[model samples]
Target: MEASPARRPHRLDPAGGCPHAVNARLLARGAVTPVELPGGIEGMAVLGHAALKEFLQHPEVAKNQRHFTALREGRIAAGWPLLTFATVQGMTTADGDDHRRLRSLAGRAFTPRRVEELRPRIERLVAELLDGLERAAEAGGGVADLRRHLALPLPMSVISELLGVDVEFRDRLHHLSSVVVATDTGPADAVAANRELVAVLGEIVAAKAARPGGDLTSALIAARDEGGDRLSHQELIGTLLLMIVAGHETTLNLITNAVRALCAHPGQLDLVRAGRASWADVVEETLRWDSPVSYFPFRYPVRDITVDGTLIPAGTPVLAGYSAAGRDPAAHGADAGRFDVTRPARPGSVRHLSLGHGTHYCLGAPLARLEATVALERLFTRFPGLGLGVPEAGLTPHAGFVGNSVHALPVLLRR
Candidate 1:
């Protein structure tokens, strides 16, 4: 008798430990499958490489929530756990002409050349963070949370510096940002956090406007002041919020995931230390092996679109399975599940969907990579014998769907 079809995931647990494992199951059920979003929501998730790559650039697809029919018609309930994705407005939600216009303002300031120029600053920050970790370990027993001491603060400082937010603003911003990304947050708390983040960022944007300085926030203010094609007040605040939180979080995960990968796989760690694989290799492999983001929500179809015979109705939310795409055996071969620093580059296959694709791709990709590379290299150089403080099984996953990292990356910083 012929085998029955593989079952699609009943519901996606954003707070679950392993998104890659979930993605592996989904792969057997074709590229596109209907997934149960949190709160009994139904949506399509694209897990395969080729389908994801093709559809990401599809002309009929859009990022704007206006295209989301359920939301537009009030079918979605209030206080939904995933409401943060739909509500936060800025570069992330814009499309077509608006996206290009908004992206241009920051893009000009954040080109790869400019990101590279920040290397010295990034390096300095990495060194300082490393010092803090050492001090933390010395003061508080023998272990420090690497995610907190190093991974969390490195990119947070870099992005805040870029945006001109003072040291005082970062702690609150970090807390609120965490709330928004967390899957466990109730709808009330999540929306509340988003509002507070917006308000705080609004104040910062205003401060930059009143007292202009040599920062991206000031540059954006200048764009608004010299009014041809410019950012509206809402857009300005939204953009700042997006950059600070999203920028900080993505790099944080990149650094955290890299460290975890290296520590967990001693042979892979050997490859890096023995001069066989470079730090860049670690970054690339980590991105593929464990993407910072698992599944991002709500890519509304402008009209009906089909992938691999699965019908995605227009205005339906299509989740981008970045974590899934990374482990797609179809794209990375049978051993895609393994974390190898020296994974060879595939000529025509999707190398990694961690950074993303097409217009909605991450603008902060280069900066994230630069920060992770420096952070990883400097971190290991400081503590060659760094290892997980707790057993790998004991490590708690970040309690959020969007972030694919642990809640706390506890590490023993000395031999």
Candidate 2:
């Protein structure tokens, strides 16, 4: 009688196209399908495992998302920058040699040793957060917002410490980032938030410049200084903004989404409760079942490219629907939509492109994995009685296609 986690709110609509659901039906019929977006813009949607995987690795598919040709030709309005394009000058937006250079510089912060060194600290943060959650539950008469107390704060604290961002400034950054990412935020508010965010990041950069500390921000400042015009001033600011926004938000989604998935699936939850499955299994399954990032925006093609039979014209914008890719039955078997922690590991298992594939892959992949693994393992192990406080349908979804997350995850921390 109860809803399954895989069948949670927003997973599908009456017409059967969930907010970010790929056209599985169309994919079955063909490799590429034509579709229209919100603004009457025509584009091509790549469906199924092979087409999507090939799309991701295709050289003709440009990562340069400026949509410069469209901007110049006036296809779409050059109005206030959307949340997905907020860091246009950052590494995510660069191409060719510029992309390689920026990625290399930022890659230093997430080396294997660096991520390994963060384990103990992350575990301590998780334990401390659990203690706070227990207290909050006691104070709330046995109910607490797990997302607010644990999911959101753990990554926020970790990222701030890593970047040397003063504790006082984090609340403001969180507020701004949320507004920027949400789709429902009005143009006026988005513009205002964007301005404030730019000003705040500018101040943080100046502070780091005056006295370079041993943080990532300081190291980036040194990188720019030593390069002698290699990294522009805008590039420096963009890189820092990229780190702050991408670093915490994605991990927050990962942690929160994993918890939600477990609470909705009792059989799978029981497996973990009985030690039949590890937390790593839960994390990977969640990433595949319901990706933290619903849809990665704006990958264009440099020239006309055909997938299956559909021809995606040159300079047209295409969205890599990893949210859809995760559920491709061709890639993960007929029951790909089902959530099962006991799914057997294969020699060459299908990889979920949630964190992305290719050169533009997430730089924070190792760090995000470390945080999620430690946080989830510690949370469940500490409070074996954790369960949802609210009904599955009552959870509020984030008002955007970019982030596949709910606004909050309320739970009974102990019962």
Candidate 3:
């Protein structure tokens, strides 16, 4: 007797599933179908044009819920505070008035003018990192881990200064950020790491409150003191932590991923090196090709909603695969997977979802772009023949909810 189709195991293992799995499954069925997710998390109903639009902006979808609960536990991670409190402070947890308020306040601190003022400092930081990378290359006989000397430290230093976290404690904070963001980790471990982060942030906030230094933290404290739209202590801590982690981790991946992409695609790297393409193009293409974030895992449904005519019950978790969305052919065309630095930006281009969109656009986009452009430009310029010391497959991608980074990127600087 033939085995029933329903009882047969899926040919595509969900564990090693890539973003294209949804597309392939959709093509096979001649329609979008919900493929079962491992461990009972609701399967992603392959989204097309209408489905993608509605699901992303759906009122009932809450982005902060424990979407990975079955893989770990029902307990939410402490990092949840960053999204939840921001919802209270007016960030984009829901589709309503609160998002407007939070976005307005965050906008003030993250304006284009503020980013412009930060340009010179960012340039200096990039130069300093390059200088250090040069020294490390010389010491290691012309090869060094760029991830350590350049990719990781550059952003960590910038964010520490911006958020008023002690530069001396950055190493500890980095570890805490890593543990808190790991998806495979249990809730208890995540909570403990988050508590440690809160304590560290608490100290920084108190110091800033006392001194009111020339940093974003101090500015926030002043906003609080003036009273009209002051931030509460919890809000202050939550926002500060969010900015610090968001700023450092995402930019770190941006630099590391760009370097890796360039090295792997030497033709593209040569274009960047020859000045045929600007660092901005390199940054944009890198973001589209290997997005810093694999997924944005929080979205709560405000009401029962239908996506592509498939009903997702109210409050059900919806995970937007930014990496998936960026490569969706319906959005970017059949050649969406190709990395073309020269691809002109169209009015409605969706080639990159690195900065997110709709109500919860990234707050530090300008600063991140500034840092990446400067860092990559100087990096390639300083070491004209730089190439990865290890093979592409040897690099370990970071396993986490928020970032896609290599464990270390060792490169030979052939100056």
Candidate 4:
């Protein structure tokens, strides 16, 4: 008889600790027990580089789910919509062959070449935003909320341009995206928002179809019409929704986190300001120090499997803590938690699960990097004496999900 196929590992009780707690210990000991969720069978199995590499590259694991019953029910109780526009039309929930096809189509528009071509435009947007920030500081006695003025709008503006959506409508769309992501909102509210967004997207799609332009929306419409790769109405709508939400929300967090990290670490900030250190390193370290997308939800074993000697049954829900992995001492040594931009690059120098791994790796990784790098460079260059106007403790952290964001990042643009 042929040998049996290898089984995926599982961990029972999996370090009965919150992801942050587990990460603290991991940063000290180089490894720890896998972290489980409030409900058993749903938690991240904290692993070192070796295990993480295996887990991320594993073919058996899948991130797509038809509906997040637990998350949905939670949202319903909070009074949000059952299926927000994003849940109904986003591509992250797609799996297997359908996922592959959709990703391939979107990949064309997200290519490195396309993103590079948009660099000058992104820089221009940054310059415009900074000008507003400068005005806000001068008007507000040298202090302004960077989150409101820069971090939030920068990505939203870029995404709007990419999707061919009206930037003037960002506030409305941002409200819908918030409802879609907020667990505090009840299902009904979320459902309503989803419906409204879908309707809006439908109109945009129809308009683009009739008068195609040179935007991603037009590209998608063209593919559906002239190209052989015809996309269903739902796919087109969902893909567009995903692009708007994922493209902006995640990038927003990234910019906010980078700014916050630098403020908290003055030495690092000085390095960035002086131009003595590469902005690339600063960005990478910031990403590892406090990754924007904290934990991502993924499905558990498809069959009974053992992970590091623990057995987990099939159909379980698990969340992998990418933030926890980035701070793991085993991977980054004793100073894993330190924000050091001058740290030399090693074999795994810039390794962090921030962009995720395996088949679910973020496709917007390059663009996000470009946006952050350009935005930071422009901001610091324009406002060399930029400093937090509010007390660090006064900053309000964004609740829910793995996003490390503060509601307002007040900075004094005194150059």
Q: Which has the greatest lDDT?
A: 1
Q: What is the lDDT of residue 392 in candidate 3?
A: 78
TM-score of every model versus the real structure:
0.95, 0.90, 0.84, 0.84
- Residue 196 in candidate 3, Cα distance off native in Å: 0.4
In candidate 3, how many Å is residue 377 off? 0.6
Model 3 per-residue lDDT tens digits across residues 1-415: 2211222222223223234454444533422234443233453443353345556655556544333333235433344422332232225343455456545656776788988887899889888888898899889988899999988888899888877778777998898887765555455675678779889888887877788877778887777677764456666666776777788888988899888888878888777667788889989887876678755555655565556545555544454555555566666678766777776665765546668766677888888888899898888888778899888778776764345667789998987
lDDT of 1 by residue, 228-326 (tens): 768877788878878987889988888999999989998998988999999999999999999998888768888877776667789888988888888
Q: What's the residue-level lDDT of 231 in candidate 1? A: 82
lDDT of 4 by residue, 1-415 (tens): 2323333333322112124554575434332244433233234453454455556655655545433444534532333222342144345666678778778878876788988988999999999998898889889998998988888888888888888887557788877776666434445675687778788888888878788788889888776766554577777988888788788888888888888888778788887667778788877887777777655555445555555444434454555556777777767778877888887655854467788776767888888999999998888777777788988878776755435566678987867
Q: Using lDDT as the measure, what is the rank order of every candidate, best first?
A: 1, 2, 4, 3
| Predicted structure 2: lDDT | 0.75
Clashing pairs in 1: none
Per-model lDDT: 0.85, 0.75, 0.66, 0.68
Candidate 2 structure quality by residue, lDDT tens digits, 174-251: 888877766556667877887898889888988999988999888888878886756887788888778888888888
Residue 263 local lDDT, model 4: 75
Clashes of each: 0, 0, 16, 20
Over the full model, what C-alpha lDDT does candidate 1 score relative to the true structure? 0.85
Estimate candidate 4's alpha-carbon lDDT, on a 0 to 1 scale.
Answer: 0.68
Worst 10 residues of 3 by lDDT: 1-10
